[model samples]
Target: MSKDDLKEAEALGRDLMWILGLIMHSGPEDRQRIALAYNQAQELVASIPKDNGDARPRIVACFERSDTYKAADDVACAGWLLTGMQERVNERDLPDWRKLRKIINNTVKMLTPPKPTIH
Candidate 1:
């Protein structure tokens, strides 16, 4: 991936971590919202094309992390996955790194729920 794209993906990963932290500390009702958001994000991820062979190992690691996320009932899946994406970008010089980074970053965005508005 280009330097800019990698930076953006890193930023998204940080945001996902912060959001997951908030959800973890919040009440059950808020956690429910986050869970719903995660469900929606699964659909979004399914629609994204991420067929990068170079990043396969990282993707596999992320899948394992995702299993831990689900086991712990945590919304930290995006954070874990983003970390994998960032690593892939740093470790590989694949021609399609840009597309891969974009897909991963978009998944992070989809995993993030909109902030609740206060009246």
Candidate 2:
């Protein structure tokens, strides 16, 4: 990624962290603010370039997965994921494209709730 791209990604990561923090601490009464921040974070995530390899996909996947539930745990998971993304960007050593995609696909299995079984 170019220097500008890196900077932008870093900024987005920071923004996401802040938004997630807000969501975690705010109560249900703040639903409107939470929703707005969530959408803004989604837009920020989408603005990240695909050329960044694992960075974008990993963030996107984790963010999407987090959106699956209204629970605090999922929000915390997203915060953790964003922290890792920021670290990778700061280190300038994102995972390879192929590996990151594989990881993202596998995350669905790991994070998804078990399907109900009908007798």
Candidate 3:
């Protein structure tokens, strides 16, 4: 991929991260905002160039089953996209990218519901 393609992917990753944050904080009663953010993220992912190997297709698949709001999956997909972008930019060790990846990991953890106790 070209430099411009990497940049565009990075921008989309950042935007999707923000939208995922919004979705995390939104309540079931706030379906409108959640739906909007979901759609926006989907569009952003779709806008990513197809030359980035299979990352774009994989990320897009994360949003295909729309019945449930899988925040953890969505956040993980965004992180995966960013990871691909970082690799393409050849800056995996950059402090900024590290920090972003950390945040994405934490967000995914927080969004994941606890497992049943099986008492």
- The TM-score leader among the candidates is 1
Candidate 2 has what TM-score? 0.32
Question: What TM-score, computed on C-alpha atoms, does each candidate reach?
Answer: 0.36, 0.32, 0.36
Rate residue 51 of model 1 by lDDT.
60
Candidate 3 structure quality by residue, lDDT tens digits, 1-119: 56765575567467647646654675644434344444455466566755546444535444443323444544333333433343333334333555556555554454345578986
Reference-based lDDT, each prediction: 0.56, 0.47, 0.47
**Where is model 1 more than 4 Å wrong at Cα?**
44-119
lDDT (10s digit) by residue, model 2, range 1-90: 568665655555455545455555656545343344445454666666655455656455545645553365444444334433443444
Which pairs clash inside model 3? none
Consecutive 10-residue window with the lowest summed lDDT within model 2: 104-113
lDDT (Cα, 0-100) at 8 in candidate 1? 58
What lDDT tens digits, residue by residue, belong to model 1 across residues 10-116?
66456546555665576656556555645544454444456664545545565577667758877655455555555555544645566556655655455456789
Question: Which residue pairs of candidate 1 clash?
Answer: none
